[model samples]
Every structure is written in C-alpha cells, then in structure tokens.
Target chain A: MRIICCVKHVPDTNAQIQLAANKKDIAREAISYVMSPYDEFAVEEALRIREKNPGTTVAVITLGPERVDQVLRTGLAMGADEAIHILDPDSSITDPLIVARCLAQVIKSGGYDIVFCGRQAVDNDAFQVGSAIATMLNVAGMTLAGKVEVDANAKKVKVERIVEGGTRQIISGSFPVLITAQKGLNEPRFASLPGIMKAKSKPVTKKNAAELGVDLNTKMIIELLEVPVYQRKKRVIQAGEDGKSAVKQLIELLRTEAKVLE
Target chain B: MNILIVAEVSQGKVKRASLEVLTRAREISAGGEIAVALAGAYSADAEKTLARFGAGKVFYTDHDQVSRQNPEAVFELAKMCAAECKAGLILLGASFLGKEVAARLSAQLGAPLANDCIEIKTAGNGVVVQRPMYAGKVIATVQLGGAQNIVSIRPNSCVAKESPAEAQAKKISLDSVSLKTSVESLEIAPLKRPELTEADIVVSGGRGMKGPENYNVIEALADKLGAAVGASRAAVDAGWRPHSDQVGQTGKVVSPKLYIACGISGAVQHFAGMGSSKCIVAINKDAEAPVFKKCDYGIVGDLFQIVPLLTQELSNSRD
Candidate 1:
C-alpha cells in the first residue's frame, strides 16, 4: 500500500497578520511558519494507516521554496518514508488550481494508491486544491473526512464526512482516491529526538515545475488587500450593584439603538 | 455574457443559500442572460421561486447521479449546463456540496475561480470579487483573469429578493454515472437549531461556560432568540461542543445580524470567524475581557445570571 500526504507551510495561527506595503499580500517577514494544522492531521492519519497495515509506505509532498523543507522534514520525523518537494518558484501564487495541477503532475508518476490533503489551507482559506487535484487526476474525490476506514484487501475505503448542519455522510469507495482531511481526524504526534535524528538521513527528492511540465501562470490575481475594518461600538454597561439594570439597558440598546432585535 | 446559477433543492425546498446566490447574480449579471440548473427532484414551487428571482431559464434533471448531492454528479450536470447556456460565469452557494462541485468544475473547465466571495461585481469587461484571507483578518480584492469564471459565494452574504420574470423551463438529461464512490447512508443530527452559517443571529459560548452541561444556559438563550449555537475553539477543543459548532479561524466563519458572545474572550481567531456580523454583544464577568473592546454592547456580569435573564426578557417580549 502506498500513501501520499500533501502538506503546506503557512503562518502560525497565532501570528498577527498584517497587509504588506503592496496591499496585495500579507507581510512575509517577522512571521513564524509552521505546518498547517489540518495538514498535521493528514500526515498523522497517513502514519496511522501505515502503522495499521504493514508494508505500507507513507510519503509527504509539498510545493514551495527552500522554507518548505522544514515541513517535509517534520513529516519525515512523523514517520513518512520519504519526501517529495516540487520546487515552486512562486510562493505568492494565489491561484489554487495551478497548485493542484503542479502536484497532480508529480503524483501521476508516483503510482500512489491514496492521496491526503488538508480540507483547506488556513492562510488563503481556499477549499479548492484538494478536490481540484482529484479532478485533475480524475480520481474518486472524498472531502472533509472526519473518519476513515480502509480495507486494503478489498482495495476500498469508507469515509464519514461532516457536512453543514451537522450531517454525516457515510461513503465507501475503491482505492486510488483522494481524501481531504478534516479536524478530529486524528491527534498528531510530536517528533521525538530519535525520530528527528533518523529523519536527517531520509531521502528528500526535489523537482521543479519546469521539469514536471506544469504551467506556472496564475488565473486569479489579487487586485488589492486591506485590513478588515470593524465599527464596533465597544460599549460596556457596568453591572454595578444592580446587574438587572445593566442587562435591561443592553437589551434596550439591542432592540432600539442597534435594532438587531425586534 | 451568460450566467448559470446552480440551485440545490433539499426535500422539495430550495436551499436558501442558493436563492441568495441567485439574488446576487441578478444584481451583477450586467444585462446578461441568467439561467438556473435545478437538477434532480424539486418542486414546482421551487421552479416558480426561481423565476420570481429573475431566472430567465430553468434547466433541471432527474438523473440518478445528481439526486444524491454527490460532487462528481453535480460537477457533470453543471459542466453540461455551462455549455448549454454558453455561460461565461457560474455561481453556487458555498454549501457542503456546492464548494466541492464548484472546485472541480472550475478545474475541469480551466476557469479562474473565486471561492467564498463576499462581494462580486462587473467592472468594465472584467469581474471583481472581494474575499477574506488569513481568516478574515485581511481582505483581498481579486480579479478573475480567464474567459470564464467560477464563483462560490458564502451563505447569507446576499439577501434574496423577488423580481418576478417569465422563465422558460426545460428539462435536461444526464447519464447515470457514479464516481465509484457512493454514500451508503446519511446520519443527520437531530438538533433542529438553525445552522450557524445560515442563521441571522448567533449565540456562542466559550471557556467561560466552564463545562459541557452548562451549555444549556447558552442553548436556552439561543432557543429564545432563535439563533444558531456557536462555540469558540477553546470550547470545542475541550470537548464541550462539536467541531461543527466551532467558530474561529480553524472553524466556521459566520456573518450574522446579531452575535451574542457569552463568556467568550474576543481572540483574533474567534473574531475572524464572525467579525463581519452587523451587531456584536458580549456578556462576561471579567471587566477586561477582550470581547468588550470589540463588541457593540458589553455587560460585565456572570453569564449564568445574564443569559437566563436575557432569555426571560426576550421570551416575554416575543412578537
């Protein structure tokens, strides 16, 4: 069995985001980057699947510049057998389709049975690449998988995905499919000292978009970027000794001043 | 230019989000023909409803594939409709099925896509879309740079208005093609509360709620206000609420008319999910909690006391 998890290096969730001077992108400097949280779940799930079935090889793939090597090494420490880096010349590409196409071009030659991608990248918040990859490869695309059950012998798997309004769709499909990871899929483990040392010796293959025959043109262009402005009243009614009066005043304001309530 | 609005019908009722997209489409269509694809089993009232929302043509299908809300099926149907209508742009609500289908359709057609758009407009010969990135902390105005465009809009981003017009209804045929992956069963949660994304008003709890069982107070307030229940990431990680209820950068982003934060400190991530709401109210015991600084109204009091009292007041004042 062969599995590949596509990971991305994004700004940490806790980092304060600010627009760059260009106003079309965020400030890249002074921001710490980590593996996207959902991608952590994908890599963790891939490792768990490899553990359940012997002779399974788990590999991690990423498309970025030199900085992406950190995420790939972390994936190696998490028990992936190898790493594939498609040296992306443009990290500022806002178009998810080109990313999907570049990754698909490489995965097509890898002969992997299953592919894992995060539900959405936290940085761009675009939930397109995972399914777009599936489309590009013409693979059975299952998204937002909160729970996965694989039957390697039958070459099939069953997935329970959470949709809106709290509905869970139980779906079963054959191997050679794409699964987008959702939260609660699994708890990712930290790399131990020995694993980190071992990862240093693992093979890290690097390729570029030109060699892969992938196009680098962007379709969606960011015209402008700005910090979101909020017109919050920031009004605080002190409860004082009379909490009820404060509650009454707030309710009245909601009904009349803000007119949020009838 | 021709535009196709894909509508989702659940149990003979059109998804309100779809109508919202159609309404937005009617606004920015710019003298272009607006068509609708109401594939699978839907009601006549739905067809009429589409016409009332400025759909000049309604194309529907009952193929075995499209009835299940499967991504592959809907993608096929939409691809066909785009060609039939000669659509230069396609719009779908960013619902569970809509997002997946829109993604695939855009990739297959090689159209530039703008997903989760809050606003879209036609400027000169090109189209412009505005969306939030970095979890709504940064807003991006993007330009679509292709012959065709695919846009999936967020629910409740636009309000549906009636603009009755004559709609030429027709039926389209699709083959029974499955993606080799099929749903065995659907387990719908019994909770009938409004979905967080679609609700006009939202009431959310956080670590201040303390325990899972204490959500009843929050739920009581939500029930009275008829708002969806939301939870901050802190509450979800502690297993006090389901992941679907989580509202933050890692969770669902909501834009409701009224957002009541019960015992939730206004972290940037949490605010990113719902900072666009029209009104925000916070109730917490801590005077210095960050929520007060970011809310339209704040009451420095115990949620245990304030929530129930607010619920009682709302119930008494109900129309």
Candidate 2:
C-alpha cells in the first residue's frame, strides 16, 4: 500500500502575530514556524496504517517556499519513507485553487492508494484545499474524519466524519480516496535522536509550479488586513468579601444586567 | 448581478444560518434577483419561510443522491442551478456541508471562493468580504476578483430578518452524477443538551476540573443554567471529555451569547474559539490566569466550592 500525507508549514499556534509595515501581510521576521497541528495527526495516522500493513510506503508532500523543507524533514523523521517538496515562494499569496492544482498534479502522478491532509490550514482557515484537490483528481474525499478503517482486501475505506450537532456520519469509499484529518484522530510521535540523524540524509525531491504545470494566477486578493477590535465591555464582578458573595453577585448580574437567565 | 443563496435544511426546517445568508444576500442584490437553491427534503412551509425572508426565486431539488448530502452530487446540482440563473455571486453558510460543496463548486466553475466570511458588501460590480485569520487575531479584507464569486458566511455572524416579498418556488430536476463516495450509515448521538456551537450559553471546564469524574460539577452548573457543556483542549487531552466538546482553535469555534469558563487558564487556542462570545465569565482559583483579563466577569475561588454554590443559587432562583 502507498499512502501520501500532505503537510503544511504554518506559524506556531502560540506565535504572536504582528502585521508587517505594509499591513497587508503578517510579519515573518520574529515568528516561529511549525508543522500545522492537524497535519501532525495526518502523518501519525499514515504511520499507523503503514505499521499495520507491512510493506506499506508512506510519503509526505508539502507545497511552499524553501523554508517548508524543514517541515518535510520533520515528517521524514516521524517515519515517512520519502518526501516531496513543491517549492514556490509565490505560493504564499496564491489562492486555494492554485495550491490544490499543484497538489493534484503531484498526487496524480504519485500512484498513491490513499491521500491524507489536515482538515484546514490555520493561516487562511479556508478548509477547501483538500476537497478541491479531490475534485481536481476526481477521487472520493471525506473531510473532518475522526476515525478511519481500511479494508485493503476489499479495496474499501470507512470513515467517521465529524459533523455539527454533536453527530457523526459514517462514510465509505473505494481505494484512491482522500481523507482530511480532524482532532482526536491520533497522537503524533516525536522524532528520536537516531531518527533525526537518519532524516538528514532522506531524499527530498524538489519541484516548482512551472515544472508541475500549475497556473499561479489567483482569483481572490487581500485588500487590507488589520487587528480586530474587541467590542465587549468587560465588567469584572468584585468578589466583595467572600466566595458566597461572589456567587450571589454573579447570579444577579446574569439575571439582571446580562438578562441571559429568565 | 443575480445572487444565489444555498438554503440548508436540518430536521424539517431551514437552518438559522441559511436564513441569515438569505438576509445578507438580499442586501447585496443591488436590485437584482435574490434566488435561493434548496436541496434535499423540504416542504411548502419551508418555501414559505424562504419567501418571507425575501427569496425572489426559489430553485429546489429533491434528488435521491442529494438527500445523502454527497458533496459531489450537491455541487453538481448547485452549479447547474447557478448556471441556469446566471448567478454572479453565490452565498452559503460556512457549515460542514456548505464548505464542502462550495470548494468543489469553485473548482468546477472556475470561481473564486471566500470562506467563513463575517462581513460582505458590494463594491461597484465586485464584492468585498472580511474574514478572520490567525485564529481571529486579525481580520483580512478580501476582494473577490472574478466574474463570479462563491462565498460561505460564518454562522451567527449576521442577523436574520424577515422581509415578506412576492417570491416564486420552482422545483428543478437534475441528472444523477456518479460519485466515487457512498454513505455507509449515519449515527447521530442522542443530544441531551443543545449543540455547543448553537447553544446560547456554554459552560466549559479545563484541566483544573482534575479528572473525568470531576466534570460532574461542570455538568451540574451547565444543567442549572441550561447551557451546553464544553471543555478546554487540556481537559479533552486529559481524557476527561470528548473532542466534540472541545472549544478552541483545534476544536469547534463557538459564539454563544454567554460563555462561562470553569477552572480554565485560557490558552490562546481556547480563546480563539470563544472570543466572539457576547459575554465571558472566568472562574478559576488562579487570580492571574490569562482568562481573567479577557473575561467580562472574573472570580478568584475554588471551582469545587463556587460552582455548586452558583448552581444551587440559580436553581433556587428558578423555583
């Protein structure tokens, strides 16, 4: 079995984001980058599948500027057999269509049985690329998958999708399918010392948009970016004297001022 | 510049978020027709509700494949409707189903999409929208730069208004599109409380709750206040709660009217999901927890003592 996991390099969730002087883009100088959290789950799931199915090959792929090679290395150290890096600095400003197009081009030629990606990228939060890629490739795709079971012999996969209203939908598709990882899928593993050393020598095949024949034109453009203003008027309820008083005061505020309770 | 709004139905009625999208579409129509596309099972009553919300034209389909909510089939039907209507802009609620359909439609139609938009407006012949980035820390103003644009509006961002108007409802038939995916089964967990995202009030617990058994205190408070139960990532990671109940960047983004945090330290990720709540109340023993600074009300006390007392007080008041 050949499994491919798509990963992305994004600013750490805890990074302090500051707008650049132009105010159109985030300042990148002082920010630390990490593999997107959801993608970690994707990689972990792929590794687990490979472990169960002996002789399965797991490969990681990412599309970004040269800095994204660091993320691919992390995937390699996490036990991926190989890595593919689609290097395009201009990708930073492109839309999901272009990104999906490039990934589709690569995956179409990679001969993978299944594809995995983070449910959404944190930077844009578009949550579209995975499904878009599936559409472009004309493959079955499922988003927000919390659990997956593969019957390789039947050439079928079943997934439980996280839906609204605290409900889940069970979906099944054939091989050559795409799945997006949601939280609670699996816990990712950290690289050991030896794994890190081995990853340094792992082959990373680099390509660009021109070579991949992907159009870089974007249909959406950022006009402005700014920090959002908080509209809430925070009125702290003083403890007054003791815990009992604080509870009483809070209840009063909820009933009267907030009017949330009848 | 005809506008098309995809109306979603849950149970038997139209979703509130879809109604909000219809309302927003009416504002951006610029005197053009505001059309609504309804898929799956719907009723005359649902059509009447859409008409009252200013749907000038209603195009509906009850195709067998679409009833399954297959994104491919749904996208095909929506794309065909948009083509027939010559829709210049398509609007949908940024829901799980909506996002999936919009993404595929954008690719098939070669249209640009802006997802999870909070604000959308008409700029001459084009449309501009604002959406949160970096987990709501920054809002980016995006301009749709194509002949046609597809947008998914975030839930709870816009208010739905009733504007009765002369509307026509037409049922359209679409040819079945063979899809690679199929639904094996759907299991909806019996909900005892409101869904976290749609709940008006939410009571969340964090690691300070100690263990899974200790969550009973949080549940007691939630029961008294008639609020949904939520959990911080720390609590979910500790196996005290399910991921579905998690409220944070990695979890579900909620915008309840009142969000009460119990024993939570208010990590940045957690704040990202609930920052849009109308009112925030933080209850923790640590007076200096980051949540205190952001919350509308802060209480420095042991949750074990404070929560039960608050629940009792609320129950007494109700009686």
Candidate 3:
C-alpha cells in the first residue's frame, strides 16, 4: 500500500499573532512555526497503517516556503519513509485553487492508493485543500474522520465522520479514498531521538510551482490583516466573600444589561 | 453581480445559517439577481421562506442522492445551478455539507474559495471577505479574484433579515449523475441541548469541575438555562467529556449569544474559541483565572456552589 499524508507548516498555535507593517499579512519574523496539530494526527495514522501492513510506504508532502520543509522532516521523524516539498520559497501562493492544483498534480502521478490531510490548517482555517485535491483527482473523500477502519485486503474503508450538530455519520467506502483527520482521530506521537537522527538521512524531494506548470496568478489575496475588534464589558461582580450575593448581581446584569436572559 | 446561495435543509426548514447567508446575499447582490439552490428535502414552505429572505429565484432538488448530503450530488447541484444562473459569485452557510460541496465546486470550477468567512463585502468588481486566523486572534481580509468566487459564511455572523423578493422557483434538472459513495447509516445522538457551534447559549465546564460524573452540575445549569453543554480541552483530554462537546482552538469555535464558562481557568486556546461570543460569563473559584479578564461577567466561587444557586435564582427571577 502507498499512503500519502499532506501536512502544512503553520505558526505555533500559541504564538501571538500581529499584523505586519503593511497590515496585509502577519508579522512572520518573531513567530515560530510547527506542524499544524491536526496534520500530526494524519501523519501518525499514516505511519500506523504502514506498521500494521508490511510493504506499505508512507510519504509526506507539504506546500509552502522552504521553512515548510521542517514539517516534512517532522513527519519523516514520526515515521514517514519519504518527503516531497513543493518549495514555494517566497510563500507567494495563498490561493487554494493553485495549491490544490500543485498538490493534485504530484499525487496523481504517484499512483498512491490513499491520501490523508488534516481537517483544516490552523493558519488559514480554510480546510478546503484536501477535498479540492480529491475533486481534482476524482476520488472518494471521507472528510473529518474521527475513526477509520481500513480493510487493506478487501480494498474497503469504513469511516466515522464527525458531522456537526453532535452527530457522527458513518461512511463506508473503498480504497483510492481521501481522508481528513480531526483531533480525536488518534494521539500523534512525538519523534524519538533515534528517529530524529534517522530522519536526517531520509530523502527529501523538492518540487516547485514552475516545474508543475500551475497558473502562478493567485486567485485569493489578503486584502488586509487586523486584530478582531472586541466590545466586551469585562465586568466582574463583587462576590463579597460569598456566593448568594454574586449570583444575584450576575442575573441582574444578564437581564438589564446583556438582555440575553428574559 | 449574479449570486447563487446553496441552502442546506434540515428537518424540513431551511437552516438558520442558510437564511443568514441569504441576508448577506441580499447585501452583496448589488442589484443583480440573487438565487438559491435549495438542496435536500424541498418544501413549499422553505421556498416561501427563501423568497421572503430575498431569494429572487429558487432552484430545488429532492433527489434521494442528496437525502443524506452526498457531497458529489450537492456539488453537482450547485455547479448546474451556478451555470443555470451564470453566477458571478456563490455563497453557502459553511456547514459541514456546505463546506464539502463548496470545496468540490472550487476544484471543479477552478475558482478561489473562502470558507467560514465572517464578514463579506464588495470592492471594485470582486468581493472582499474577512475570516479569522489562529482561531480568532487575527482577522484576514481576503479578496477573491476572477469573474467568479465561491464563499462560505460562518454561522451566526450575519443577521437573517426579510427582503421579500418576487420568487421564480424551479424544479432542478441535472444533466448527469456522479454519485459514488453511500452512507451506511447516520446516527444522531439524542441531544437534550444545542450543539456547541450552533447554540444560542452555552454552559461549559473545565478542569475545576473535577470529573465526568460531576458534570451534572454543568448539565443541570445548562438544562435550566436552555443552553448547550460545552467543555474545555483540559476536561476533554482528561476524559471528562466527549470531544464533540469541546470548545476551543482544537475543538469547535463557538459564537453563542451567551457563553457561561464554569470552573474553566480560561486558557488562551479556550478563550479564542468562545471569545467572539456576544456575552460571556465565567464562574471559577480562582479569582485570577484568565477567563475573568475576558468575560462580560465573572463570579469567583466554586462552580459546585455557584452554578446551582445561579440556576435557581435565574428561574425564580424569571418567574
């Protein structure tokens, strides 16, 4: 089995984001980057499938500036056999259409049986690239999978899709399937010291946009970047060393001030 | 510009998110026609609701293929409807089905897509949209290029207002079928309160709640207040609640009208999820919990004592 997991390098989830001087993009200098937390689940699942079924090869792919190569290495250290870096050094491309095209182009020629992507990237939060790639490749996509049972011999897969509204929809399908991993899919493992040492020796294949002949004109561009304006009243009622009085003040405020409670 | 709104239907009525998109559609339509490709179980009442919500034209389908939200079917429907109206822009409610269909359409149409957008407007010949980044810390204003754009608006971000357009409703006819996947079954757990993302009021618990069995206090308050039950990542990771009930950066981002955080210390990631809420009330024993600083109201007392008292007092006050 040949499994490919697409991962993204994004700013650390805890990083404090501020707009750049132009106010059209995030200030990147001081921020540290890491593999998006959701993508870690995909990479781990890919490795687990490889472990259970011998002769399976797992490859990790990412599209971004050269800095994104680190995430591919992270995936490699976590147990992927190879890495494919679509080097967008300038990070000029922000369009999902272009990114999907570049990714689908590579995955289509690889003859991979399965592909995995995080439910969404923490940075843009578009969560569209994987499905778009599936559409471009014309394959069955089981998105937002919380649990996946793969029948390698039968070429079938059963997925528990996490649909909102507190429902889990069961989707049963065959191979050549695309799966997007959510948080609860599995616990992503940390790369060990020996694994990190071995990852440095693994092959990292670099590909670029021009080589793929994708249309360079980005379809989506950031117009402005700003902090969200908040109007929170930020009031903390005096508890007066007890519970009853504070409860009274809160209920009063909800009625007269917030108007949320009748 | 000619715009198409792909509306999702649940339990017969058009979903609130769909109607909310219609309200946004009326604004960006710019005198051009605004239409809706109302998918799933189609009804005249839904059609009328669409009309009153400013749908100038309504194209509907009741094909069993869309009975359980087959993404391919929904995508094909949206594609044909977009072609039918020559839509310059398309909008969806950013629901699960909506995002799925929109992504496929983006690939099929070779157009840019902005998903889960909060604010949308028209600038020049194209559209500009604002969406959250890093959960909600930074807002990115995006411009969708080309003559066509596909955008999905976040739920509860826009108000659904009545515009009362003359309806030109039609039965949708597809040129071909591309259904492949089948749903074995869709099990909806019996829910007593609303889901985290869609709820109007949410009462959430954190590590301070202590254990799974102790969540009853959280649930009790939630039941009395008519709100959804939510949990912080700490509680979820500690196995105190289901992942579906988590509200934070890793969990569902919520914008309920009122979010009551009980026993939660207000981690940054947790606050980022519910920070956009209209009103926030935190109840934690720790006075210096970060949640208190960000909330509209705070009560520094043990949730075990505070929550139950608040529930009874609220009911009595209302009576």
The best-first sequence of candidates by DockQ reads 1, 3, 2
lDDT agreement of model 3 with the native: 0.87
The CA lDDT at A216 in model 3 is 70
RMSD, each candidate, Å? 1.5, 2.0, 1.7
Those runs of model 2 whose alpha carbons end farther than 4 Å from true positions after fitting are A90-92, A231-242, A255-262
Which ranges in model 1 have alpha carbons more than 4 Å from their true place? A90-92, B176-178
Put down candidate 3 lDDT per residue, A1-262, tens digits, no spaces: 9999999999887777888899977899988999998899999898889889999999999998878889998999998999999988888888877888999999999998889999888888887988999899988887888998989999888888768776667777777989899888989999999999999999999988778976777778887888887777878875666589989989989989999988
Fnat value of model 3:
0.79
Tell me the tens digit of each residue's lDDT in model 1 across B3-92: 998898866778889989999988888789999988446578889988888899988888655665667777888888899999988999
Where's the lowest-lDDT run of ten residues in candidate 1 chain A?
A: A86-95
Q: What ranking emerges by lDDT with the best candidate at the front?
A: 1, 3, 2
Q: Judge the docking of candidate 3 as incorrect, acceptable, medium or high.
A: medium
Q: Residue A193, candidate 3: how far off, in angstroms?
A: 1.4
True contacts kept of each: 0.83, 0.71, 0.79
- Highest-TM-score candidate: 1
TM-score of every candidate relative to the true structure: 0.97, 0.95, 0.96
Residue-level error in angstroms, candidate 2, position A51:
1.7
* Cα error, candidate 1, residue B309 (Å): 0.7
Q: Tell me the number of clashing residue pairs for each predicted model.
A: 0, 0, 0
Name the better of 2 and 3 by lDDT.
Answer: 3
